[model samples]
Target chain A: MKRIAYPAAIQALIGELKRLPGIGPRSAERIALWMLQSRDARPLEVSRVIREVQESIHACPRCGFFTTDTLCEICADTTRDAAQICVVEQPTDILPLERTGVFLGRYHALGGRISPLDHVGPEELRIDALIERIKAEAPSEIILALGSDVEGEATANYLATLLRELPVTVTRLAQGLPAGGGLEQADELTLSRALAGRTAVKG
Target chain B: MKRIAYPAAIQALIGELKRLPGIGPRSAERIALWMLQSRDARPLEVSRVIREVQESIHACPRCGFFTTDTLCEICADTTRDAAQICVVEQPTDILPLERTGVFLGRYHALGGRISPLDHVGPEELRIDALIERIKAEAPSEIILALGSDVEGEATANYLATLLRELPVTVTRLAQGLPAGGGLEQADELTLSRALAGRTAVKG
Candidate 1:
């Protein structure tokens, strides 16, 4: 069916909006129309912000998290434990860990995991930078906070072997039943891990 | 707990993105980060389109649908039925009716309905413009294709009473059980409307 052709600019706006993750054609249209018609709508403000982010925001050279500064805020802070580094798959993952207040150390974004099907290897990631940081800082421990997927496991194993010569303790996030998870709802692998890694209750 | 401070531009982008319907803080962050980091992401293109839409698109002089031209495409089209105009609460509604291929007539967007709580009265809508168009064009029929809500009913009734003086047939979209709707799932009012509005299946 031939589409009801919106104005050239409206159509262009819709097409551009649809490029965002999870935004489909209907959602794109709704957003475009809302931006155009609503009295209180601030399309200009949105546009300005988009342009500013494009011009200013970039990956931190040292840690790979987003920042407009020469060095990201986390990297610039002297209070964080420089002797421990947490490795993650993407820069976005840093927030949830930070919110938990569990790790007071620095971060290293791998950019991606080793996915053979997608032709992504360690060379494509920030592994070399991580190694350089490890060598320079000589961190006491390196926490692999990557996902539990097959690719994450492969990348972790590869990194472990490569860093064997370095004088640092290597560890991974524990695999078991997640917090607030039910035994009945837990998958077989998680159940088995929980059983194998169980600890005695304290008095 | 204190939030991880994103760059001024990045935080501003996320906040602006959250203004769009259905986009929350988490989704906003995800989209902003994706725009900043992804190799194929087109923040510039999106920014350009938004600016163009904001600068160019406006209400068409004749029919009130959005257009960059002096007149909307539908109003400019010489082939459409000039004697029949479909009245809608908003410009966005015109597309779905056009997609059905059931209405080849032009459209008149009222811009809004009469909502007392929101302080929107008949004066706020394009009712006067609609009346003027009806007088000038002498349309044979005016179809009210507003929503099935209370405001829609009130607006339709008000329009119908006001249009009683004119020599034209005024009708509304039929309300009944929707296409492919099941009797078990339909509400009481819908079932009753369907029963009352029933017609014999044609051969």
Candidate 2:
């Protein structure tokens, strides 16, 4: 005779839970039990939130940051400087910059860096969209917040070349951030240092 | 204008992917993309495995090991001895024991130990059912494979008293496991020590 009773639905959740990183088969079982016990708390709520985020989420038309509306809040804000835009590889990279209260403008998400080994090239990133934005918006400066990785540098170099056609300043976050550090992980001091020491890319 | 386009249906899956342990929002995105890309690989087939497991999964009636049918294969195996039942706090503990392959019989998942701090008591566990099983089957010995932690000791003590009323012998896995060592994380050597040195509870 089976001891504990669980319906098929719960098991499905547990199996899916196991597929996540750091969660082993055992940990998945614990989480499944916890979520079920707190069923009133409704883990489905987490999934619901996921669905909500997925349904309403979209990238900012001007910059690549995530948003619920057509344009990310940063890009929609007219009060922010129209002449400057920060460029990062991902939306999560914007958090530290927002916390710094330093840059008051817009952002551009490259989707990812260019890694030829990974078959990701300039065509794969938002380089063309960024070029289109520069031409349309005519920003005075583009601050590159890309990572210090080989891929990030290549992407930055690719961006610099593309934007050379525009009559705008092209710059990179200074050398303060440790090489290979993701922007999301960089400390406030490091981010401030990088932001302060930003160098204008020579065309 | 947003640069990239992904199907809305695919984005929903990504959001669900992020809710798992160690999966950050970005990793969630990547997983979602990968899963979507592999949709032709019978994604639902995987989910079907999950669903089938969820729908059909049942723990062993006698021991708490996971199973699909009435009794876990180990519990139902007519070849294994029914005269002995190794006891543990959680289902995961069965793994190391299984790895040792020293004892040949069945297992009993007590659900967890008695930790008053966590409001866990014998009442919350399957201890009562275990007593019933011990009485009904008249096992030759009851080997407790609980951790060497304070809670595990307390649980072993409690079960010893309960099993004392019976005609069978009650033993505990030795304290060869270091203090605070969990059965789940114990090395094979440590686990083997405790397993080999199992002693009869005097009380």
Candidate 3:
């Protein structure tokens, strides 16, 4: 327990901060102290936002990305090509590609890839939804925007086999970019490599 | 504004985090996301804590440090000697000396030092309360456990002058620690410098 009153709240804030990829307990406390520096924090107006998000935000029903609405903006846009679904793991990964304004299509957010040892497998993902979506929309192509890692490759291979009989083209993202980095952290050249190296599959 | 529900609340969280001594916008967003990751963060819980702190946690009526009641733990502890009031800038600064278990006395948090550039002067600080505390407690020694900076020196000098007529010793924490270096970050050798170089106040 904190020797102070806001200790729990501060600790909670730190706990939340630690969930981020690089942050730790010390960094989290530093952040909480920083937030508490201003006078307006007395309103808990800052803390309320944290609690409100815990109370309201949820995954986009269609894309699995955090969104307040039922569907993400990308999924809701009717002008975009619904026949091409660019699949990715996290929402932050969508920004860089979106900045390029190159691909115009919808998206499918697989919660994560196949890593049974890590307890993340096909069941934990939205694979069934993708299949259902493919059967319903009959997208011309299903872009595998997963990382070029063991899990990514396993997921892509499984999906290709599952969608073999479908009319839609099943393809992996291009290679030569990197083998293990997430789409969010990949450089433009690497992303371009994966994008360019994309090859058609027998399935 | 966050393009999400309760934009004000989200903005408030971001603003509050930014107000913290060192957080940036990206970190603020991550903290917000972490809170949103769970539902135990009720609005009542968030708001109540803030209100409770605003109402309950106040400057110890005597020492100017945080206290749940009128008097802080240091001031209330009957076993401690009342003749020595260790003056510090913030409540957190008192911890380092406490860890050493070297001092057995009360404390006075000045809240801040004399900094003309930021317009933080004697009036803006708890210097008056410290003076009042000195008069009331009549400590034999007043240790200025403050930062090793111009502001600290100025404040210490000013306090020494104010207490010149009083039959008490006003000693500073020390000086060779170097300007702008915090006690928290300084090595053991540097800290010893501040302690060893301490001398009698001219005033």
* Superior by TM-score: candidate 1 or candidate 3: 1
CA lDDT of each candidate?
0.89, 0.73, 0.70
Q: Is 1 or 2 the stronger prediction by TM-score?
A: 1
Q: Write the per-residue lDDT of candidate 3 for residues B1-203, one digit (tens) a residue.
A: 11223234455666765654455777766655555434464433544555555555565677665556666667667888888889888765765667767788878888788999989988988887877777777889999888766788798888889888878898876556667877898888668877887778999
Residues B50-160 of candidate 1: C-alpha lDDT, one tens digit per residue: 888888888998888988889888998888889899999998888888889988888999999999999999999999999999999999999999988889999999999
Error of 3 at B9 (Å): 7.8
Best by TM-score: 1
Worst 10 residues of 2 chain A by lDDT: A1-10
| Model 2 alpha-carbon drift over 4 Å, by segment | A1-56, A176-203, B1-58, B177-203
The residue-by-residue lDDT of candidate 2 on A70-110, one tens digit each, is 77667767788888889998766775688777788788888
CAPRI band of model 3? acceptable
Ranking by TM-score: 1, 3, 2
DockQ of each: 0.59, 0.10, 0.29
Candidate 1's residue-wise lDDT over A1-203, tens digit each? 23467877888889989989878898898899899787764888898898888888888998899888898988888888898999999998898899888788999999999999999988999999999999998899999999888999999999889888899999988899998988999999889878888888998
Per-residue lDDT of model 2, residues B1-203, tens digit only: 22233435445656655555455777776655444334253344444444354445566777877777787667777888888899988876776687676877678999889999999998999998998998888889999989887899899999998878889888877657777878899988778878888778989
The RMSD of every model to the true structure, in order and in angstroms, is 2.6, 8.3, 6.8
Taken in order, the candidates have interface RMSDs of: 2.5, 8.0, 6.0
Clashing pairs in 2: A8-B54, A8-B55, A11-B54, A61-B1, B64-B109
The per-residue C-alpha lDDT of model 3 at residue B119 equals: 93
Model 1 residue runs over 4 Å out of place are: A1-3, A195-203, B1-3, B182-184, B191-203
